[model samples]
Target chain A: MKTLRVPEATVTRLSIYSRFLERLDRNGITTVSSGEIAEGVGVSPAQVRKDLAYFGEFGTRGVGYNVKDLLKYTLKILGLDQEWALAIVGAGNLGFALCTYRGFNVRGFHIVGVFDNDPTRIGKRIGDLVVQPLTLFPEIAQKENIRIGVIAVPTSAAQEVADMMVKNGVEAVLNFAPVAINVPDEIEMRNVDLSVKLEILTFNLGFRNAQSL
Target chain B: MKTLRVPEATVTRLSIYSRFLERLDRNGITTVSSGEIAEGVGVSPAQVRKDLAYFGEFGTRGVGYNVKDLLKYTLKILGLDQEWALAIVGAGNLGFALCTYRGFNVRGFHIVGVFDNDPTRIGKRIGDLVVQPLTLFPEIAQKENIRIGVIAVPTSAAQEVADMMVKNGVEAVLNFAPVAINVPDEIEMRNVDLSVKLEILTFNLGFRNAQSL
Candidate 1:
């Protein structure tokens, strides 16, 4: 595997391309050109080729790409070829929604545990999983070999939850709490601020309005 | 307002910086340097300066910036200075979570309506707002002056919801549905794929492991 550092934007686009390929593969589409992939995901044809080129050449000069082959390659490139065990802390509305979200399961992410410190939320069932206490996090994480921890708690508790996750043994964290939480340097962390996207929309609308004026 | 084309990533970083400034302001911190802002949001000092430079200079040479002033500037730049009326379509788990999300309310985003096509979900109450049917979207949107619409529906229903939002006079859309939805060129659209961030973490972990091998 070539370990040249790839741009984060390219990684994001690769995830989109992988999803588009999945849709095509489901529809039984066998072949796809860079233009087709670009059109399917709303990117330029050259961009599609450029992002794919970072990994390796996957298509012929004019033959384009084989849908299944390209899908497999993108999935492998995205580290989705194998299942990842996940533990979601804070069994609140966001956590509940993530627990039931079908997107994660379709992409080889399995929720092994859902946990909360609240007595009211504890023991509640979210699909096949039960909302365990934070006390059970270590045990469950060890048993399930959970690699990823999701912080779904409120702003006040996000940092504490991240600390506990790090101590327990999770390798990476995907934080949903709007606040920034600190983790060890070796642990990979990402924040998914739900409001950021809405703000982007507002910014564009405001910018356009300004331009017209 | 200068109409220079600002990169989307800069806008995103600005949002982070704005949030950090808000935190500082709440703590009664009056002044901040680019280094402090960058440290709070985990970006390089130079990168923070560059992003803010796109909008205009905010900080002094060595005196740093007024916390409240920078906060206001970022909010204004991101169009969060004025309250934006939003209509969220779907009202499922994701929609329910979004309707109750406090982050939106803090940043001047007000949810005026929540709509769902499912009869069972239509009359449900999430927080102070009641979920209405999709039929009432146009009426409520017009009455409430909703400028933004959020699509939290399923993949199959996402495009339909986008079309309804576009037809009902929403200027911008924040789609939470994993699938891509098309809108007219005049309308601004952004997709928030929840799984994409997790894939980034997985990709990094996989790459590190591969490199070690």
Candidate 2:
């Protein structure tokens, strides 16, 4: 049978849904209805059903979703079933922090190598990984099976680093740089611009303040 | 007349619109058609017009919006017409990174005080301001007129810190902690979770991999 395609929004929310389910699992919830999961994750029950329909039928009409079975399905659907090796570029403050981040390591993702253009930081150790120079990205990726490249470099050098990572056969990249980057259609890119986030909050507060006047 | 209410989604996009407008302003573009601004911000012209209508009609039906007028109105609507003082809790790696962050200062939001429970970090100078203990939040907020709080504490301490900030009279909060937080209905809370972003990327890769199999 041909695999059913899921919307990117649905897949995005699947990660969100999985997080809520993990909380439920910890609270000893062995079963959950669509309404219950929807409320937990702040989505509509109909939307949840529609999103999960593409994967398979995991729910009964009245009994709702089985917690462990649904979690296994979510894990498989999100590729969390297999561990992903991460190559973090730029061993600066942000890069070093990400390498030592317990959150990424806890989520079936491991930072196996830290890459940088800085000579001083290249030989340093962050946790168990010895930092390597940017020149070794392709070599290290080929040998160690590193598929994701994280660009935490400064804005000016971010594009160049992204280009090199794509050239090295990285399929996906998570960019923390403040600038937008251009990557191939086949290469998936996600940008986390801290500045953009602050601007959003500023606007929110601004709107509320204006309303009070 | 009753004040017009803008949708939350439109408020979010207004920040993006303002950023693009700033680029135009820098380039000496004094006026812009709605289509021009929409194209620059990667939104449809109709959507832009619709969003702007939520506040008040600003654009000419044919000629478009006057760039300066639109920019000023958006800024006023977002409450960036004047400066806002902000307090950041937890002067750790993330907090330190945020304090030195050039974006907040540029956007009319000021990080006037940094707070932490650690004695070693408190009283340390980060830029022009000295770090203070969590106990100083109320006094600092009152003295400095800080209206917003940025919470970067660990998950274990997030709720306690947030509760303190709220009691100290912080009406708006931007939480960087990965866990979900409970706030009073009157307080506006926004959570920025980096792990959720990576998980979204994982799901994208998963669907693509599954399709190829």
Candidate 3:
């Protein structure tokens, strides 16, 4: 491994920058300065430059960066240039919502399989796919070459579901169960806690009110 | 304002620390050190202390912090000590998921109203509350005294829903619409883009692979 030791926060910024660049590209923008990107994304120009530095030199010394070229580079760095098969392990409302979530589809993430343990939901259609039993996760995962798994089940079942995803050869996992799950060190995992986001807003509001006093 | 501005990152960490403290309280743990809190929450001990420093001292020199006391303090700091009334606009699958999400209820958030513009979804039951037409937002928002509004509507309707919420005097907004929204500076707003979280994971995975080469 390279000894540079990139920070996790940088990766997150790169992701944000990538999305911003995509929007720029879509708007017929050809080139963008660091300041422009910063203003567009609510970050500082220095931050934009610093985050881009970790990957490689993308912008010219004086001239700005090409919108399309920078967008492509960022996506490649984020591993979104290639198609990724995803297996969602719940057919609940959250899972059903996720199956149709436009964000994933636009980023080349394909939910090839939706698995659940509920018998009543087994044949339920969510979008274009029927829910499959959890037992079929292994077979479908192998057949579809699924790498990333999303856990949208209850808290009690999150760990078990994560374990199954690991056992079935999924590399990265996006868990939405609002609980921290243990996965192998080699396996990448991220938790998407919807509540935490709201709490952040509340904290800011509270902090602002406290400061005013 | 207090003039001592706290970083949004600190607010996020405080939220995580609050949740970790809740789990400790549930386990009957009465005391926890900053190191232990940091370990449980996957943050550095110094970070835990720094984040807490933004508010006030909560830990003793050697005895650490009282679990219940710290939990209470963090929850209060996050503005979660008192019940908050919420209004969620939209009754789609995503909206349904947010309405029933246990994370909000556990943290003292109550969805008093669910609104939708679609006539078909207007009377649909998400939990105990039935979805009302968006035209009723002003009346219900006034009646319920909602302080926080959640915009889970489609992209096209998100801005309008946010405007309606603002017009009804909602103080803070948590948007899940995957689009950047403009609100007045006095109003607090945060976006919970699920896709951005996944993109962060993909970036890390890609960066690690590149380093290994």
Candidate 4:
């Protein structure tokens, strides 16, 4: 095995490319060039090639690449080839949204549990799973072999929930608290800043307005 | 005014830098070096300087940057100087979450309208505003002078909703539908892939496991 330090940006692009390839595959397109992939995903062709180069060569010099094979490779690299059991904490509106979000299911992530500390929310049903109290996290985590935990709680409770998740043997965390949370060095963690993309749109709109002046 | 073609990545970094600076401003921090900002935001020092250089020189050679002034500059560059009125389509759980999301309000984005086609959802209250019917979108958009629209509908309705938003005179859109949506060239549009970051974490976790084998 080789020790590879791939840039996080490359991983993000791989995810995007996988989705683009899925579209092409569904559309019955058999082959695609780097240029086509780049155009489909709104990225530069050179950037497409550069990001892919971090992993291994996928496309030919001029004959392009098979869409299905590329898609499979991307998904495999992203660890979507295996079924992942996930637990979403903080069963508020955001947590409920996460539970029903189709994107995770499509990517082979199964939400095994949804937990909350509030007594009223504990017995509530979100999808097929009943919300359990936070105290049951360790028991449910062990019973279900949950590896990934999502923190959808408020800013104040995010770090505490993350700490609890780590203590219960979760390997990775996806935090949606809008605030940064600290985790152990060994844990894989990422913050999903939902508002950042909105800010980007506003920035561009503002830029266009500034240009018109 | 300059017709500058700033990269989308630069806009994203600007948003992150702005948020980090906001935290610093709230903490009463006066000055920050590029290295400090980079450390705080998890970016490289040179990358921080380069991002700021795109707007203009903000820091002295060695004196670093004034936190408040840089915060204001980044916000202005990102169009946060003026309040942005937003309309969220699809008053489901996701839309309801967006309506009350503090992240948007903190960044000067006001959710002036929430719309849905469902009868049950139409008469419901998200916060201070009641959910309106889809037919009322045009009227409310015009009355509230909505400049940005959020499509929180499912993937099946994302494109159609985006088209409607474009027709309703929206200048920008933030899509949470998990599908790629097409908008007119004149409208600023961005897709929020909430599951991509989770996949990235899974990828890294898989990579680390593979390395240790």
- Candidate 2, residues B1-213: lDDT per residue as tens digits? 126665566876787787777778889988888888787766798888888777776877777777778888887777777787889998887787778766667767888899998999999998887999988889989999887889988999999988988898887888888777888977878877766667777777876776788
Model 1 accuracy (lDDT, Cα)? 0.91
- Tell me the docking grade of candidate 2: medium
Which candidate wins on lDDT? 1
Residues A1-213, candidate 2: write the lDDT tens digits: 137656567877888788888888988999999999998877799999988988777789999999988987897788888888888998876787677666678667888789998898889987888889889888999887887889988889999999998998888899988766888989888877665566566666665665688
How well is each residue in B1-213 modelled by candidate 3, as lDDT tens digits? 245877778878888898899899999999999999988878799989988988776778899999999888889988898788998998898999988888877787888999998999999988798999989999989999999999989898889888888999999999999788899989999888888878777777776777778
Error in Å for residue B125 of model 3: 1.1
Candidate 1 lDDT for residue B204: 95
Clashing pairs in 3: A211-B2
TM-score preference between candidates 2 and 3, better one: 3
lDDT of 2: 0.81
- Clashes counted in candidate 4 amount to 0
| TM-score list, all predictions | 0.97, 0.89, 0.96, 0.95
Local lDDT at B141 for model 3: 90
Candidate 1: regions farther than 4 A off: none
Alpha-carbon RMSD to native, per candidate: 1.4, 2.9, 1.6, 1.8
**TM-score rank order:** 1, 3, 4, 2
Sorting all predicted structures by lDDT, with the top scorer first, yields: 1, 4, 3, 2
> lDDT: which is higher, 2 or 3?
3
Task: Name the candidate that leads on DockQ.
Answer: 1
